[model samples]
Target: MVDPSPESVELARFSLWRSKLDCAFGWFEDAERTIESLLSPQAQNQPETLPFMIFIEPHLPRMEGLELLHLLRSHPSTQALPVVMFATSYDETDAARSRAAGASDYIVKPVDAREFMQVVSDTVARWLPVGSKKAD
Candidate 1:
């Protein structure tokens, strides 16, 4: 997750936990750190250690989510990774930009806690293997 908001990270963590999905979540405050970690020697040596998906907020402190998405797409190591761009409200322009930048999906975060949790769980499940318990 590349959101600086602690609440958002906690919410996503809780949602995944409630759904009984076993995923190692890494929360980064900015795109630079995330990029560094993802491009590190360890991660490059063992690609399986990379995340199954990435959740990013459109507006971040440093680099914008769309910019980060472009960077990820430009890199060979992260080109195929699934990146989901999200925001507090629906914006057609942002959604279109995300899609153009190669984001796997785009979502407008739900206000209701339950709905948010459901959305997060469902999104993650979509990226998991069909028969995996994580997807169930």
Candidate 2:
């Protein structure tokens, strides 16, 4: 998770706990750290270093989400990594921009907890195959 909001991180963790998805994650409120982690040399070769899924918020602390996504896609190490953009905005234009840059999906933050959980469940089930260990 690459969101600056502690609530988002906590909510994600809580959702994971509630769902019992059996996955591990790292959260970076700062985009710079997220980029560093993704571009690290060991990320490609080390199973523990790679992420099963990456969730990014569109409005980051420094760079915008789309810029970061573009950087990730251009990098050889993270080009194929599955990335999901979860944003508060309901604008279709932003969603379209994210999709055009090779994002796996763009989801708006739900107002209801149940709806968010359902979305999370669907995202995990749809993106990560039953037996996958290094995709998200």
Judging by TM-score against the true structure, name the best candidate: 1
Alpha carbon deviation, residue 106, candidate 1 (Å) = 0.6
Candidate 1 structure quality by residue, lDDT tens digits, 1-136: 9998888888999998999987777899898898888877777888887887899999988799898899888877889989999787889999998998899999988988889989999999898766665445
Model 1: lDDT of residue 23: 78
TM-score, one value per model: 0.92, 0.87
In model 1, the runs with Cα more than 4 Å from the true position are 134-136
Number of the top-ranking candidate, with lDDT as the measure: 1
Q: What does candidate 2's lDDT look like per residue over 3-76, in tens digits?
A: 99887777777777677677775799978998777776666566557776788899998798999999889977
Q: After superposition, how far is residue 75 of candidate 2 from its true place, in Å?
A: 1.9
lDDT for model 2 comes to: 0.81
Question: lDDT of all predictions, in order shown?
Answer: 0.87, 0.81
**Model 2: ten consecutive residues of lowest lDDT:** 127-136
